[model samples]
Target: MDKPTRLIEFESMLFTRHTIPFNARKWGAERELDRSAYVLLSRIQIDGPLSISQLSQAFGLDVSTLNRQTAAMLRAGVVERIPDPEGGVARKFSITTEGERRLDADRARSIRSLERVMADWTPDEVAQFAGFLNRFNRDIERLEGRPWPRP
Candidate 1:
């Protein structure tokens, strides 16, 4: 298959062009959180006390962007900076109690949304869809020359 044709079809299945902008609005209306900030917080809450550099790399963002987001989180008391136990020039951040509360609320809302969307789906169908989605992601990464990393 031609690369452009394949890419177009894959993206169409994965994303709705019209609904792309709508997701941010929906997420914000549901939680009073900006989509970018919410995504940043979710990443941190799931995988922190990580350094700013780590986050920047993981999210494919620049240092400045990560710093700005981290600063906002700190000001909101959603994340706290701590001296890196690993001893670095960089400081580490951990999710605070408020952060956990926010994460839990967001998770609950997401679960409800997913449940409602999938109400008619059978458990077996859901499992198969999830499995295929995972494989699709892996295949795309491979095609892009990103070999899957070890867990």
Candidate 2:
């Protein structure tokens, strides 16, 4: 195939692959937390507290959308709003102990599912795939000027 054709095929495959994690069988059905809440908790865990505006910029989402999501999170006790550590007027969201516990459990479940799916893959193959995926994400983040902090 020509390069352009190949790129198109790759993009389609990427979207298909992205859906795997969101599949109910893989990660959704086993968790009480919705994907949005899990993702928000994960971000706060990695990046520290962040205001809705900051999260909106990082995720390329609207402030109103984040406001709604964070409101739900607050009701669930997954996060708490506090004065921004940077002394901003806006409040930032931070994960609570309950959120941490739930996030960790959900993450463990997802990892187990992935492990089962990749049971036949060699360790080297797994490591190489992880490296490539990480590189791809980092490059995109760089271009977007919203690089996630490295664990």
Q: Identify the candidate with maximal TM-score.
A: 2
Instruction: Estimate the TM-score of every prediction.
Output: 0.73, 0.85
The true-structure Cα RMSD of candidate 2 reads 2.6
Worst 10 residues of 2 by lDDT: 20-29
User: In candidate 2, how many Å is residue 34 off?
Assistant: 1.2
Question: Which residue pairs of candidate 1 clash?
Answer: none
Residue lDDT tens for model 2, 1-151: 7998899679869766765445646444468578899888888999999998889987889899999999999999999999888898999999999999988877877777778778999999999989977998899899999887777
lDDT of 1 by residue, 1-151 (tens): 9998899798866666433223534544356355566777677766668798888766677989888888888888888999987888778988888888876776676666666667899999999977987887789877765433432
- Best prediction by lDDT: 2
Q: Model 1 compared with the native: what TM-score? A: 0.73
